[model samples]
Target: MAIRDVRAYIEEHGLVETADEESEKSIWRKSGFEGVRSFGEMEQILSRFIREHRDARRLNRAQVGIMVGLHETIFARYERAFSKLHVTRLIHLCEILDCSPIEVVHAAAPHLFGDNRKEADDKMKLILCILDMPALTAASLLAMIEGLVGERERSGD
Candidate 1:
């Protein structure tokens, strides 16, 4: 199904309130599951994506909830089940993981997977742009990111 059809399904399922145009629009625009084969497929896609991001920011239950727009309890309750994750939340989580939505879906589907996440993450973190703190000296290099007096500001932030 295309985005329009996905939106229609959500509307039919009463998942989107008529008053919340933004939520409705968000589902269509950002949902990674659009045209995906099944909820099982959605689950596989997000699980691997989360695994890839498990080290960064160390997403706690609450953080995962925020990323997926589900309640903390909901996230905790469903953390193990791939079928419960929403497509919209999956896409948003990919953004947080600094990966594309396509990557998440591909990662989930073993049959279609091409990239090795561990390798990619290692390489991605090596990129200068990902180094929040550029340590110019041995002393600075010893400093952990949280130890930096000035939280290195992101370029656009």
Candidate 2:
């Protein structure tokens, strides 16, 4: 479904406002996301991702609900955007679906990966490649990356 449709559903269900009543801000306006333009889009992306992952695994809402210890209707609310998906609940759902929580986050905010789609896609591909590597190889790469990052930090890059 389109984000607009999800947004409409959320509005219709009276789920659009937080208790704080602050206006929604673009993700980029927050610290560490200075250039992002996506605003208030994560909820839609998250709902879609959850539903897609569940479908891909051939699991119904009831099955996933049992795995996550939530009632089927409660879990369905999340996928239907009638309720917000908290981080802890997202982690539990991801575990049950055998999907990476980071993947869902990436889908919600690709700008976190890079400044543009191509750059983001490249970084995401690199990340997936690292995940597919042998454990020792992955560890070696991690160490190398750490060393490079440390050096860059020391050099004020």
Candidate 3:
């Protein structure tokens, strides 16, 4: 069975939470996400991306549906988050939208895609730009900093 079906079974059987107000939910909650909640969130993000790209491209629902081999009603439901889209359909959507899967992923959950490292690297570049230093000078400065750090480590400081 699909993960959604499993989630539905668990919920229907009261495995996640009790009907009583005093009872808390399951032990499976993490970062505000349960299995079914994750699916819903993904659907929302994907639907928004598809709609935005389709509108920006000035493509109508019928056009996208024909391009992706889906009926217009189904495509409309997909955009409205009334249906789940498979991975293959998502790839087809990306191709029709003229966007890459990486772009969609970065848009959907940027936090999961090395965004902190990218932001830090960008800040470092900004700092270098503000300093107005040449590339060679920046390289030399980084080397000096590394050397100093190594020396301090070796001296147990």
Give the best candidate by TM-score. 2
TM-score of model number 1:
0.38
Tens-digit lDDT track for model 1 on 34-119?
Answer: 33234454564466557647546676778767876778777654446634656776677667667665555455543333244455
Order by lDDT, highest first: 2, 3, 1
Error of 2 at 42 (Å): 1.8
lDDT of 2 by residue, 1-157 (tens): 5565766666564443332223544211321243332333567779999999999999999999899888999989999877889999999988888878878878877767886778877988888788789999999998999999999999999
Off by over 4 Å in 3: 1-37, 115-157
TM-score of each: 0.38, 0.70, 0.52
Q: Judged by lDDT against the true structure, how good is candidate 2?
A: 0.77
Q: What residue runs in model 1 are displaced by over 4 Å at the alpha carbon?
A: 1-45, 110-157
> Where is the poorest 10-residue window by lDDT in model 2?
26-35
Tell me the TM-score of model 3: 0.52
Query: What residue pairs are clashing in model 3?
Result: none
- Model 1 poorest ten-residue lDDT run: 28-37
